[model samples]
Target: MEISRRRFSALGAGVAATTLSGTLSGATAAQAETPPGKPAVRNVVLVHGAYADGSSWAKVIPLLQEAGMNVTAVQNPLTSLADDVAATNFALARQDGPTLLVAHSYGGTVISEAGLAPNVTGLVYVAARAPEAGEDFAALSARFPTPPVTSGIITSGGFKWIGRSAFLRDFANGVPRKEALVLYAAQGLLSTAAPTTSVAAWREKPSWYAVSKDDRTINPDLERFMARRMNATTIEVDSGHLSLVTHPKIIAGLILRAAANS
Candidate 1:
């Protein structure tokens, strides 16, 4: 299902045209403009990564809702890749029509497994992992200089998280001070045995990526490499790892682009 660069270029051009027209409002708008027999995407399923929950998508959710999209933010268990993917699939199954699957941080890994669902038409990775099938994301990330936040991850018993200090300084650096503190207090943790994937849906689905230029959680270079390798439509934002919070408009715009293109 790998798309040729030429095909992606053509797709990107079409998306750019739709975006410029400013007519997209949701699946309805896409449907009205679509050529016969094309899928119209209106549903969006969001997945959050380690150290966060579904609330991580709070900012982007309202924006998408205002655009007339039916949005569902999944509450991943973060216990294992299988459990998280199951949670995403549960959300995906409720979508009435084609859906745009969006992921942040480790949530990207969840969507990589669950996005193969029949209703999923596209994927948007926001400063998130886009591991190839059978690829070890940790090993892949090792190719780039490790981001400072990785060193701050603290594991106890079987779960992993960053302390409030590390969360504020490294994980949510660009976030407002007060809000970063709140996010730290509500931090989630991942199980020690969370597995990587061998079935990345981006292989067949059209994908978009948002790279945080100043990201300290995941290296920007690593994000770029994964985006390029997946042939995703990529947008770069100058923000921290939590770009979805700091730059909701940009992330929502990318999702809309994926919706139009789907």
Candidate 2:
């Protein structure tokens, strides 16, 4: 459903904060440095997880560009896990040289699989899910007690899902009240099928993660657990579920670091 204009502005502001916070801290340093010529890295492909779309990365795009990095924010259809991976891989195939694949929320599962792309140089997770073999979103969520907000999204058919008011309660908790309302209003209807991954994708890729300590949708503990398993470089942000939007600069810095290392 489309968000009302007023709500959209609020959501934009909230997401803007999440996307730029990473760069804001080192603003002077980033501004003083010359943009890497041509392309220091081929491209950075951003994948947004469930309940959101490409707009999620709007705030972070400029920062990447300012660093002279080409960026593509994949607009995942959120129909099925494999489909999302294929879409991401298609994006990866179009880029030259090394590429950084970044995922948020459920998007992590997509990157875990799609990251197998030959061009991928690194993987980054922003408060995202990093699943192991045969683990689906439900299985992972089952391992942890259902967070109060998630407990409320009822699915009537197998693998079909809907968000309840709890979407506002959990995912958007720390977001401004007005912005949270916009997010709640604009949130996408995700497929239960989208969260289930067939195999572990990060085993072969160099990876990193940004954990939102106060995230309610996916437990922060789960983020740490997955990061440890992947042997990923980790950074903790004191934000909520939409950390990318709430703390973009931190996320951008991590992405820039990943790009530099790759």
Candidate 3:
């Protein structure tokens, strides 16, 4: 179901307020009792985009955990953008300390709208969509044409997504050929309706964006535009759409930076 512009605006406002409250509360608590020389804080919450589950983060999770930071990956239902946001928020609510909300592919839209969760001190976009209010994936793609690689997707109702071959070619292009093939074979069909995001979180949130210079799915130009508009700390990588998988170290470093700054 498409979220109306008005509804998305309302949701954005509510989420912003919720995030603000959380930020303020955390700040207040931090000021109450803290030694001057505290180590840099690091808490990460990862959100995967459409057609993928939390397992998409499997390759990167251990890396983050190994760095001595707490991490949580939200298993979004990929049902609707709002539903995904709610799931992300639920994960955020369960975390202790501050958080860096990271999004991949369509998860960018989810995090853009839901990053307002109180503990969300910052945001990291990994070759993901960061749409503004009233924007959908189709609208953003139109500005910078991306060769269509979704012809393999099969949907009974209104759901739309990429097929296995398309996933390997477009989504997992720069990844290891063998692993890309494996991921393509194990890919999930996503709800087409979820790409319609109602709110824009970049306008208010401090965000960091990772641009996949070799992305075959989302255009690199659009990634640059979204990052510029959000005034985000931007990092460019020569990877495909699944940079989080192929270049987890780079993505992790950016997340760690954001968490540290937060």
Candidate 4:
């Protein structure tokens, strides 16, 4: 079933279809000086998670750039955690000033590490994971209901991908079927071997989270736990896991908020 747009308007502090709360993510407002001799910028770097490519952010980019913000989407190789982090850092290195590092899904894990780059001023997590340093993500996920997407995994040559049926049904739950097909066609594969982070950037940098209330890929409750664990400013949208694709403005709005607060 598709979620209605009206559900977007119902924001609150409870586990409803939509929610927004200024919970403590334990982050501070103190601004770190831009690197000496480096000019600051209102830049945004987007990171896409497994089973997807940078094109996933196509809808959100225009909105951000139109608002006079510099935007770049990182093309993660999805081969390993280190490779994805390197790709993100490379994008950050190219930014002219303080940047908001944003991620969707597994991409959340990317920013949690790359965000430590001195130029990043804030973080935005959209229906994404925000694991602590050395945390066993699989173990953590196990604490929640197993997402059916796990059954949709297709593995070959040590790389893993989501089956088209599952991508449309679960991973891209609320996205239009046609667009979800395109996303599946443009999807990338992740390594079968699990990747972990050494540090959690949300612990240091101010953070914002957009929870996909109707998400089927990751347990909705788990998303809330991560957002509250980091004490992030949080919002819940009545959409699926691909909120970035289905609700670009909402994601964009959160990024703008992060930019303003950070």
lDDT of 1 by residue, 141-192 (tens): 8889989988788989899999777789889988999988888888888998
Per-residue lDDT of candidate 3, residues 35-151 (tens digit): 246554567889987767788888778767876788999988877777888999999888888778899988888888887777777788888888888775686678787554656
Model 4 has an lDDT value of 0.80
What is the alpha-carbon lDDT of model 1 when measured against the actual structure?
0.80
- Candidate 3 lDDT at 227 equals 81
* Poorest lDDT segment (10 consecutive residues) of candidate 3: 25-34
Ranking the candidates on lDDT from highest down gives 4, 1, 2, 3
lDDT of 2 at 170: 83
List the lowest-lDDT window of 10 residues for candidate 4: 23-32
* All models, RMSD in angstroms: 5.6, 8.5, 11.5, 8.1
- Global local distance difference test of model 2: 0.73
Instruction: Pick out the ten consecutive residues of candidate 1 with the lowest summed lDDT.
Output: 23-32
Name the runs in model 4 displaced over 4 angstroms.
1-41
TM-score (all chains, Cα) for each model: 0.86, 0.81, 0.81, 0.85
Residue-wise C-alpha lDDT for candidate 4, range 1-262, written one tens digit per residue: 1122122222232211122223212221111233456544489999998899999999888877776689999999988999999999999999987899999999999999888999999899999999999998999999999988889988999998899899999999878888899999988989877788999999999888887888899998899899889888777777889988887766766776567557
Off by over 4 Å in 3: 1-39
Clashes of each: 0, 16, 2, 6
